[model samples]
Every structure is written in C-alpha cells, then in structure tokens.
Target chain A: MAALAPLSTYALRLGDDALILGQRLSEWCGHAPTIEVDLSLANLALDLIGQATHFLGVAGDADKLAFHRDALDFSNCLLVEQPNGDFAQTMARQFLFSTFQELHLHALASSKDERFAAIAAKAVKEVAYHRQLSSDWVVRLGDGTEESRARMTAGLDWMWRFVDELFQMDELEAKLAKGGAGVDKSELRAEWDRRVDAVLAEATLARPASRRPVLGGRRGHHTEHLGPLLSQMQFLQRAYPGAVW
Target chain B: MQDWPLWEVFIRAKGGLSHRHAGSVHAADAKMALEHARDTYTRRMEGVSLWVIPSAQIISSDPADAGPLFEPAEDKIYRHPTFYSIPDHIKHI
Candidate 1:
C-alpha cells in the first residue's frame, strides 16, 4: 500500500478528540448526580476510549500514541478537553460534539479506504447513541425548571464558539476528501445546523448569536485546559515508563 | 441534584422472547429513563428491545402477607406434576 501520511494524521486527530473527551467524561465516574447517570457517563467514556484505541491503533502504537503525546502533539479539536464545568455544561459539550461526530463518522463510513471506512462504520453507531443521550439531556435541562433552563442556556453559550471549528477544513482534509478517503466537513455544516437547530427548538432554547470561531486545536494550539488534563491523563505512564499491571 | 423518579427496566434479549426484568434507573421522565436503562443494562447489546416503566406506577402485594397468600398452596401436592408416577412401560412419558 502507498504511504498515506495525511490520512494517518486525520485518524490521529479524530483519536485525540475522542481520547481527550473520554478523559473528561471519566472524571464524572463517581461524581455524576446519580448512580444511573454515573454509569451512563462512564459507559459513554468507555465508548469514546474504545474509539480512541481503534483510531490510534491505525495511526501508530495505540498505547504510545495515547500516553506519550504532549498537548502540542495532539490534533484534537478544541471543543473537547474543555473542563467539565457542570452537568449542564458537560451535556452541552456532549450534545454539540457528538452530533458533529455522528455526522462526521457517518460520512467517513463510506471512505474508499476500507479500513478507515470500517472503523468509521463502527464509530458512527456509538456516536449515534451518544448523540441521542446528549440531545435528550439538553432538552431535559433546557425545559426542566428555571434554574436548569438558565444553566443549560449558559452552558450552550459557553461552548458555542467551539462549534464552528468542527466543520473547518484544511488542505489535507480537502485533498483526502477529493480522493474519497475523507469527509468534506464543510458539506456537513448544513445538516449539522438543521439537526442542532431542531433539537434546540424542541428544548425551547435559542441558538447563541454567531461569534468568531475558536480554531487551532487541529494545529495543536489548545486552551489552557488541555495542559492540566494531559498532566493527569499522562501521569501514570510518565511516572512509570513501561509499567504494566 | 434533581432526584428523578425510579424506573424499572426490562429487556428482550432476542426476537420472539419475553422481556425479562433487567434492573432499574432514576430519570426525570420516561425518555431519560429509557436512555438511562439502555446505557446501564444494554451496553453489551444484551437486548433487542427495552421497556422502562415508572416504579411508582406498579402496585404489589405486601411481602408481609406471603404466609397467608402462598403457604396454602405449599401443602397441596396435587398441584405438582411430579406427584403422578409413570408406568414402567411408558417410555415417552
């Protein structure tokens, strides 16, 4: 097979996004509002982490890629890795990102590259469930009570800036998309907007006014939040190199 | 912080099968309850179908009445199919 440097990078970027978000969600293991929610978050974390393993395995040595990479070396979008501010904030981030990911992976599932397509086919199913869970939570929180509605609105506003970055395309992605080995993220925007807007309408929440999109996680320029998240996630591997249980 | 109501979950593991009780979850409504039940009980694709009903809506006989409600049947050996002996020649029985 011919070398596909760009596709590998794309896979890593997707893997890192899932990995970072999985780490963030796992933080809610024992801390979620109820035992059922605790299990739900943990289960979703496991699904994302499982996707990370598959994508990272395709990119390189899965464990090394996950544990050795610094924040600067990661290619995850900025939407993930944001701190879990509250349940509402977490759900907002989950809703936005999972919806985007579901669409993204659904498109990727038809890639000309068989391996990539197979991985995406599997991931899209998981992301579908994640989208449903997050969408349901968004509606519940948005329409539940005065305090929940306020918090849900605030959460959406807080995370709104990062939404646009999910659909941004660079030269590599464009080239791969032309070759049928990648998704044209730009094309996904209209449908993403429709789905999100429908959910928001049902939730009785208005979309936040458009703002300048935050960018650069694809280039490894990340928020201050990513550094600390990496510190904890990489702690064990860094502390004891080659250690295994 | 919001203490949602309890819901009992049931899952049909395959087609043409009954949905047996799996477990329960606490959720704000039936939809969230179904989601929670799916996440909690069907992570392994254990079910082809799911049902989540509010625990509050189910009425049950008190366990304290178990002695009167069930003990009378215990002494009735004729209720047991095993009480009838098969003849030695009845091979298919």
Candidate 2:
C-alpha cells in the first residue's frame, strides 16, 4: 500500500456517504411532515453537503468525485442508498447512520494529518446535532402512540437489514486502520450497539434478530437503488457540464 | 406521530455574550427543540451558543409594564457608563 492512498480512499468513501444521504434528505425539502421538519431536513442536507465539499474537494475530484462519476466510482456503503421509506424509516436510518458517523468523526478529529483532523473537528460539531436529532425522533415515534409506535417499529425493522453496511470495511479501510488515519470500525461497533440498544429500549422498538448482512458499497457494487439516485444526481451535472449560476 | 411543542430560540454570539432572542421553530419534543434551535440560529456561524425554551413556557415583559417597570431606569444617570471609562481590553458589553 502506498503512503496516503488508503487514507484518501477512506476519505472519499465517507464523503460519498455524506453526499448520497444529503441528496436524499434534500428530497424532503418543503415536503417534510411540518414546517420545522422541512427546515430540519434542509439543515441536515446542508450539513452533509458541506462535509461532502470538504472531503471531495480535498480529493481533487469533487465533480468526478460526487456528481460526475459513475456509481462504481462511489465508495459509499449500502445503508445510505436504502430508500427513504417513511418518516420512521428515514429516522431509523438517520439514527443508525448518525450514531456511526458521529463516532467516526470523533475519532477522525485526532487524525495524524492536520487537514483531516481540522475537517473532522468542524464536522463533529454538526454530526452531534444530527445524532441527537435522529435519536430523539427514534424515541418520539417509538413511544408516542399506538399507530406511531407501530409505524416506527416497522420502519426500523425494514431498515435493519442495511445496518451491517456501516461496519463493512473495504481493502482501503483495512489498510488505513493500520495507521491512525482511520478508526477501527470494530471499536465503533460496541458503542454503536449500546447507544442503539438504549434508544430502541426507550422507543419501545425491537432490534431485529440476527439476519443475513448485505455488503458491497465500499467497492461500488450496490443494490438497484443506487442507479436511480445516481441518474437523478448526475443529470444536471451531465447536462450542464460547466453551467454555473 | 406526536405533536412536539414549539420552542423559541436565542443565540449568544460568543462565550460570555448575551443571548438575544432569535426566532422560533416547531419540534416533536424538547430534544428536537435544541437541535432546531442550533440549526436555525447558528447556521450562518452567527452564534457560538444557543438557548431554547418552549414557546409555551415563556413569560414576557409587556408594553403595559414599560412605563412603570422600565421608564424609571431611563433617568438613572449613574447607571449609564458616561461617568466611567471602559478599558480598551473590555471585549463584550
């Protein structure tokens, strides 16, 4: 492994994750359940987009990196591309992703590379709010009422299969983990387990029993879902090329 | 599924800075209130800190109270800083 190759790839992976999820959140713009929620979704989308900009820009491939590249060029894990099911589904995905990302960002804040560390430091602040927001929703929808509870549990259940994608370390991640540039996804697993358990217990939702885990996001092999997402995302960029407002 | 109460936001621009009331947001609960407060008030790098209170929980000073409660202070010249000189090092008022 050449010096910094893995780290750059690792950053690109995370950046793609943020970019895809940001696009998903933006889809809910002006269509959130309430005005406050609309703004909340909008705000989260912006935060993720900001992260994408820093990470992808550093890669020197922001366009081919995010908007212009083919799906295989993407390094995002599978969990993000899972359809935004319902509000409960969205919150469940958010809760899990935020919890994972918050820990990842926290570890990255202390990276040996000053640039990566600075990016992490700025990012963790925003990720903290995102984690809190998602966890709160998990509790609310889980505990609120019979219908709400049912919907939320179902949402979590439907999305549960995708959770393993968060921990799927690729060849690059494994290589980077040997250095301090990357956090051990295994260490993140423990805290993620505890935080998720507590939230689910409070939400009155059940964690899915062990199931077959899905993989392949890091290497760019993905479910059919990624295609539509890429098509929509790339359309403007492909069509406009260099058009700017 | 639950109707979270609304909260009004206030932002303190820096540490030790006064929290000026900013604006309001709707949230599903108290936790959401805090997140929304930070997002709405701090997005432009405008605030270093935030305060959020349920809109339902606030008690306000009214226009009716201004004459009696605030007018008297306007005449207290000693309370004004005209008599004293502030050091150049003084940062936030």
Candidate 3:
C-alpha cells in the first residue's frame, strides 16, 4: 500500500468544520426570526451535514467519525462554536466561514485525488449558496436600524479574533498540499480578504484589529462553547448507540 | 386576542408549471403566511415556488353544489374529443 496518505488529515479538518457548523445551524431549526429563514437555514444545515458526510465518509463513514470522536480528536477551529449571537452575528460568522470555505473548496476541487476533487466540486456549489445567504443577511441586518447595526458590528468584533485560527496551516496541511490532496491555505489569503472586505463594506462594518493570532482548535483546544454543543447533539446518539427505533 | 387566520399552501414544483395545493398553516399576515408555508412545506426541497392564500378567500363551493357545477360537463360530447376524427399525425393523442 502507499500508506493511503495518512487518511488525509486536511479532509478530517474540513469535515470537522462542516459537521460542527451543521450542528450549529440545526439550532435554528424551529426558532428562526421568520419561518422562511428557518426553512432556509435548515436546508443549509442539511447541505453542510451532507458535505460533512462526504468528507468524513472518505476514510469510512461520517456517523462513526462524528459521534465517536472525543474532545482531543476533533480538528475544527474555534470560530464555528462561538454561538449564534444575534441575527447579524450568526450571519457574520457564516459569512466569514463560508467565504473562507468557498475558496478552500474551490481550490480543493482541482485536487489530484479524484474522490477529493469530486467532493470539493459538489461542496463548492453548496458553500457558494451558504456564502450568498449569509452575505445578504449581513447587508440587511448591518444596515437595518441603529440597534441592529450596533449589534452586527459588535458581533463581528467578537467573532473576528477567532478567524486567525482558520488559516493556520501546519505540517499535516503542508504535506497534503504538496501531495495535491489539499490547498495551501496560505495561498488563498488574498482572495479571502478581498471577498470578506467587499462584504464588510456592503454591510457597513469594520474589521477589528487583531493583537495576535489564534490557533488552538486544530490542536484539539476549543472555546468553552463547543462542549455544550456536542453534549446536546450527541446525547441521544450516545445513549442509544446501535439502538434503532 | 384572536388567533391568526389559516392559509392554504399551493406549490409549483418547477417553472412554467401549475401550483398544486399542498397544505395549510396559520399566520398573522400574508408575509408571515408565506414564511410559515415555506418552513412547514418546502424544507425538503419539495417545491420551486409557493403561493399562500387565506382559506377564507378560497371561495370554495359547497359539496351539494358539485352536481350542478361539475356533473353537467361530464357528458358534454362537444367538450370531449369524442367528436374529433382520429388523425394518424396525432399519434400520441
């Protein structure tokens, strides 16, 4: 065997991001500000879950990877778990995450591995929709009323610090990039910034200055938020493993 | 306070198609009606478009009047294709 390329650590990381965001989005299933938006978010959540399944299923299956993994094993960054603050904050987190994911998945679509490329190609379309959905909301909520604008900017301010964790590619990512299984996230920064800046401008929000970079999530550390999220999501599944109704 | 009115949902599966009646939901206004329709009915990618109208505005006829409104058209041969000569060019029909 050619060692199977160490199970594509980068794919695992991407899967973590999708799986977590899917779980997060599922939180809005019934309580969205409007019912149309509720359905829209649910559809997007399903898409993310589907994409996560595609990536996590590459090695085996997503169910096993998602519910079976412990705290230290997850590779998702901290930003996704920061809770849905307000409408604007939710959109801001989504806008930033989807913008980042759009470029990442686009470049991954060209991967030398056919399976990876196919997954990325399919996922890019879904993420494009996600980015558009979030961008639209960001503009509306950011420019809506005085209170809403303040909340939107405040949400973005709180969320911006976690963004540095997203682009911190390390040795595993470097190996995967060299092997053509993943993109060098470093090469995608300029495009990411341009897209983000344009959306922010349209939203009439400013980016917060960062004093330092954040990078603990890929190494198994996350904010206090993810634990509670996982507990709720995994509770029934964990309690009734292999027990089907 | 009175509750919101009930609205029936009709959905178009795709463009250039008819909107078939799907179901009903309760909403405070037309916008809320549409929003509730989307959430309750279209979450599964079930329809490409939707129409939500209050049930009271549907102007449905009584079941007793069905015979008068619909039964007369049943045996109208002029309305049917039974009078038309079969042409070979109209193969599918």
Candidate 4:
C-alpha cells in the first residue's frame, strides 16, 4: 500500500472520528426518548456527518473513505465507537467527547493549514452546541432521582477508561504540531479536565476513578464495538458497489 | 416523558419579524424547553429568536366565545384603512 502524506493522514483521523460518532448518534433518529430529543440528536448527527465530509474530502473521495474502510483501518478514538447504551450513557459519551473536541477544534481553528483551520472553525460552533446539549443532560440525570444518578454514574464509569486515549499524541501528531499544521492534543487536557470537572460538580456527580487507559484507535486498532458499527454503516455501499442517491 | 410539561414555541423568523407560534415541545423545565424549541423549530434557518412558554400559561380565547369576541368586529370594517386613496408608489402601506 502507498504511504499517506502527513496532512492526508491527519484529515483521515479527524474524519473517522466525526463519521463514526455521527453514525452512533444517527441510531437515535427514531428511537430517542422524545420527538424533540430525536430531532436534536439527528441534527447533531447531520452536523458531524457534514464535518466528516469536509475532513475526508481533504484526504480523498469522502464516500470511498467512509464506506470502504474496515474497522481496523479507522482511526477514531474508542470513546465514539462505544454503543449508545441508554439516554444517560449516550449523553455521557457525547459530553466527554464533545468537551474534548470543542477545545481541540478551537485550537485547530488557528492552524497553519488553511483547510484544517476552515473546517475546525465551522465545526467548533456545532460542537459547542453538542457539548451544551450533553452537559445539560449530564446535570439533569446526575442530579435527579436516585435511579438517574446511579445510571449516570455507571455511564460515566463505562466511558472513563477511553478518555486518556483522546489526548495521546502520537509521533506523527507531535511532528505536525511542531510544524504548526496540527494541534498538540496533550495540551488540551488541562482545560478539558477543568471544564469536565465543573460540569460534574454541578451535576452532583463524582468523577469516575481513573483506570488503566484503553488505547490504540489512533493506530487503527479499535474496541470490539466498532466492527459491528462499520458493518452496518458500510453495508449498503459495500453491497451495491457505487450506488448513488 | 409523558409527564413533562408542554411548551408552546414561538419563533422570530428574522430581526424585524415578531415571533409567531411554530409548534409545541415537551420538556422538564424552561432551559430544556428552549433547547427543545431550537431543535424542533429552527433547524432550517427559520428563526433568529425563540420564545418558549408553558402551554398552560397561554390563555387562549375560548371557541365558545367566538361570536362575543370576534363577530362584533366583522361589522366594524371601517377599522381597516380601506378608504385611503394612496398612490401606487407607496408599496407597503
């Protein structure tokens, strides 16, 4: 296989993150607890899919990259690929991921690469809303009835191990960071912690105790959940072979 | 979910327009109601401003009072400025 250029690789990684998360959120389209919540989740999914299109388009044909890639080839962080266990679980995952994404995208909006900067600029606004929506749910569920609090706590615990992998800067990212083309994700951790902590405090929820970090999505390894997700997402394109709307 | 209060959503389509009733949503409180209103009504660039009122708080006119409230106005056609003979150049008025 031909080696990808550093910029192409960077775009592909970010694209994968958006695409996978969008697919997960799209699962809530008709099944969310309420019609209003359903529409909101779908709106968030559409925004992520749109962001994926821009980022993946920078690497190559967006459809080909999204529909043709296997699970082992995707570089999304593990947090996004996890199942939407329930409303609280989905909110926990979205809150954690969007908090980090908002910070990282804000930093990338000023990147030396104009394409990255442009995409990040637009996407950061959408992510800001995602963060707000999820954070509100976290507070509501965490501070509500006893059952809600237990479920929210469990949801946070289920996702906490994957949080560390989001900030792990690989050598490629380090090199790109030095060159001003990519963000140093490691640096975003402090603010992510501060913001996440504040929300947890408001929710009256204790932060999950840190566990051994589950890593490797950046290196194309993923949790068992991703394979099934990709199979569902890629099924139509894979079966039809170049079908169009 | 069924126990949540209903909110009537009003959306101002643009800066100069008054908020018009768009639809209704169900939410636990004022904040969630606003968020729900945005998600439900404004996804298509339809509004610049949003207003969400608890459905119970809006005192709508009774259908049984239609004759007493509205039929009295039907014969007062002079209330509308139809007698004005303005030039065609005055477009809106």
Scored by TM-score, the top model is 4
List candidate 2 stretches off by more than 4 Å: A1-4, B1-4, B58-93
- Model 3 lDDT tens row, A127-238: 9978877887677668677988898888888789888777888887888889887789988888989988898788787776774766699878988888888888778779
Residue A2 CA displacement from its true place in model 4, Å: 3.1
Model 4 per-residue lDDT at A169? 94
Predictions ranked by TM-score, top down? 4, 1, 2, 3
Question: In model 3, where do residues sit more than 4 Å from their true spots?
Answer: A1-5, B1-90
Determine which window of 10 residues in candidate 3 chain A has minimal summed lDDT.
Answer: A1-10
* Candidates arranged by DockQ, highest first: 4, 1, 2, 3
Better of 1 and 3 by DockQ: 1
lDDT: worst 10-residue window of model 4 chain A: A1-10
Colliding pairs, model 4: none
Candidate 2 lDDT over residue span B1-93, tens digit each: 256677888889989889999998887667777877776667688888888888989988898989999889887989867877789999896
lDDT for A22 (candidate 1): 99
Look at candidate 1 and tell me the lDDT of residue A242.
Answer: 77
- Pick out the ten consecutive residues of candidate 2 chain B with the lowest summed lDDT: B1-10
Model 2, range A1-245, lDDT digits (tens) per residue? 12336667877887899999998888888788887777888999999999998988777667767777888777788888888878888988889899999998998898877778899999998988888889998998888889888888887877778788787665666666777777678678989999999999988778878678888888778888888988998898899886668
Instruction: Kindly list the per-residue Cα lDDT of model 1 for residues B1-93, writing each as its tens digit.
Output: 466789999999999999999988888889888888988899888999999989998998899999999999998988879968898988966
- DockQ score of each predicted structure, in the order shown: 0.78, 0.38, 0.24, 0.94
Q: Where in model 4 is the C-alpha error above 4 Å?
A: B87-92
TM-score of chain A of each: 0.98, 0.95, 0.95, 0.99
Candidate 1 per-residue lDDT over residues A1-245, each given as its tens digit: 22438979989988999999999999999999898899999999999999999998888888998888888888899999888999999999999999999999999999999988999999899899999999999998998899999999999999999999999999999999999999999999999999999999999999999999999999989999999999999899999987899
**Cα error, candidate 3, residue B56 (Å):** 17
Give candidate 2's whole-model lDDT.
Answer: 0.83
Kindly list the interface RMSD, in angstroms, of each predicted candidate in the order they appear.
1.2, 2.2, 5.4, 0.5
